[model samples]
Target: MDQCITEVKPIKGFYKLSMKQRMGFGAGDLAQNLIYQTVSMYLLIFYTNVYGISAASAGIMFLIVRIVDVIWDPVVGAFVDKNSPRMGKYRSYLLLGGIPLTGFAILCFWNGFSGSLTYAYITYIGLSMLYTLVNVPYGALNASLTRDTDEVTKLTSTRMFMANIGGLAVGYGVPLVVKYFSPDGKINSKDSAEAWFVTMLIYALVGLVLLFFCFSQTKERVIMDEKDTENVKVSDLWQEFKHNRPLRILAFFFITAFSMMAIGNSAGSYYMIYNVNAPDMLPYFMALGSIPAFIFMPLIPAIKRAIGKKQMFYVFLGIAILGMIMLYVISTNEALKGNTWLVLSAQFIKSTGVIVATGYMWALVPEVISYGEYKTGKRISGIVNALTGIFYKAGMALGGIVPGLVLAYVAFDKDNVATQSDMAEKGILWLVAVIPAILLLLAMYVISKYELDDATIDKINREIESRVNY
Candidate 1:
């Protein structure tokens, strides 16, 4: 019986990844984040204050771009699963999508167009759509790597660590580089246009290099049978969502978590510059956003094993809420206001919780993919990831809408860059602290709905492998 079980392993892949393979896989997320995180963190402020568009216009454009993604993401997902590319099924996009993605990403930050709403719409929409091409494929690639749940956790940890490194680069390094290029050494002002363009050009080139490296490192192993591939349709994404209970729960969590992160990240620059009256502190504030990942992400496997995954999530998420509350108190209190150490401490705490909770969520992606396959014999990773992508964007849509509408409600004046009214400052505070904390509460509830725990997913995976071998 032991010999029979031992001989019954899948022929192609589902082996543990090498350290090199893990780093190479992680490099992909780091590369994408360099461009994507920059957009998430800075693009709105760039549009309103530097590029000459109104906050409301920029906000609406953000929404429109995401709406296009809602359509485009499913097509990309279905197309990827339906056909095998010559370069590779999923990794091919590292070259095919990365080149054009880099181009539009840099163009999104260019001031040459100078606030022309048409040009803004064209470039941004192009960037978001092409991003789907890379993002959908890349997401599917994670599931294709291996079937070992422990390996998935390590891979996700490494990926999030690299991702935060990219975030740090955008948060801290971009500003420093832009300052060097700015004649007056200011990143937020109109005159810093040349600086912004040059900085983006450099980052985009580096991202392109990382994407090529990622392409070389990754090899797709677990995929649908060729016969299964031909049958995949765009509608399969919806079908998979309806059938896979864990996937459905994970999808809602994506919306809530991404919405929470986006709202908070988008609000950071404005908070530091306006409410805190410390533009120079912006980079440091943002850098802290990713710093906690380095400190705590490595311990996640142990943490989950010790406390169990669900309990681990509850702890970190609860920590995040506590941090947000700390931020609100520090920012609003007269005695604590303008105390740099206190502000930075609160940010560190908030980020610590947010980073760990969100980072672990990616590991669950492969589990749900396994669950889908366990129920329906087809491991349609692309379609499943696409479903997650759409919901992820839905959350981001809220992120984009809330900040603009709130700022507009408070009558935030773009012309008055030097200072905003107290009402506008209060609105920025809500974006940074209160609203996000509310979403975090929703996330906790959504997580409670998730059904796949480690042992159950492992059993599902082993059963599927046994079927393949038989």
Candidate 2:
């Protein structure tokens, strides 16, 4: 085994990861999800319910923050690539960027200050920027960890598994924790703001702890070539954008898939509160979304091996759309009103498809990175990650903007104790079901355009290996 390890074909540089090393690489993702999921799942609710911001104002804020991401993500990516810190280029940011990320995330949910809009702008924008600071490097760190294709796949699966651990914690635990802190077990009641503050504070602190663990576990192995580092320019990003067709297809697929998940997840709080009239069930519904990750995530590699990646995408995405259609029809049907079991069942089914399909997409990033290196003799890992970061952030923006705008247009009232108006209920239903259904359909189309299959990536890796041997 040791001889085989030493005798394996080499690229410009090579790194081998033990199981412990691979699991450590994935710990970073767990830390990341804790912070990111806080914003993704709870921020909208915090805005409307706790801080008392109008949905329209929150929507505009979301769009502005995403636009700000346009400038910020590339800078973080490039900064990591150009400068190497003592701890390592990418992992250093976990401590530097993550501590503040934790603080800002907590602040975003705080209601101590009366300046809702100012608090919203400061905390949210800070959270977004700090998140990019940590996230971009973490992504770059993944590429730097190893060059082995199969190893990266295992690493991605492990990362996603740990990531879902964070997601599950946030999804399943937050509401229960919040309710415990609420004045009398009512999250939508007058004391809900206090509950939110308490819950976010705890989640943030726990997230910071995990960030430290991630920092302790991972290290950079396949460092970029120094001469190539000297030639690194942001303009090189555009060159890849122009020549890398698979990257473009992947970028669009990221947008569509993320948009689909975001739109659906964002609207979940509203759907349970208004349309279903069982606000307590929101956590269960949200938990349902992450549960599939546990079930299907472990099966991804085997599934991909059996059916192929492209076919796997077509299969899961089609199932996702069908689940959404079921949700829409059931939610909108008068006969199904008050049927909590039926509604939750549909959500569980819808999420099964969404979670597995989306979770597996992260594995493709390294493949595209390798493909770029094979084609151009340059491996700008930062640039590829930055581009995909933009699309994923865009999806998050749509998640924030669309539901807020739709609810605002339909006149959703945050202050109301009773159910929302009929029109608002319809809007929530559409947000949960129809809109995501459309986005999933588009995702199927975009993923179909992906040209790099396993065979192609394997071929590229072999060619690169052959060249290095001579």
Candidate number achieving the greatest lDDT relative to the actual structure: 1
Per-residue alpha-carbon lDDT of candidate 2 for residues 28-91, written as tens digits (9 for 90 to 100): 7877787787678777766786677888888889989999998877776667777778888789
Residues 1-470 of candidate 1 have per-residue lDDT tens digits of 45544566533445788889999999999999999899999888888888998888878888888898899888999999999989988999989999999999999989988979999999999999888899999999999989888989999999999999999999988888988999888877898899999999999999999999999999887877678789899988888988899999999999999999989999999999888888888899999999999999999999999999999889999999999999899989999998877888999999999999999999999999999999999888889889999999999988987888888889988877668999999999999999999999999999998879899998889889887631
Clashing pairs in 1: none
Weakest lDDT window of 10 consecutive positions for candidate 2: 4-13
Cα TM-score of candidate 2 = 0.94
Over 4 Å off, model 1: 1-13
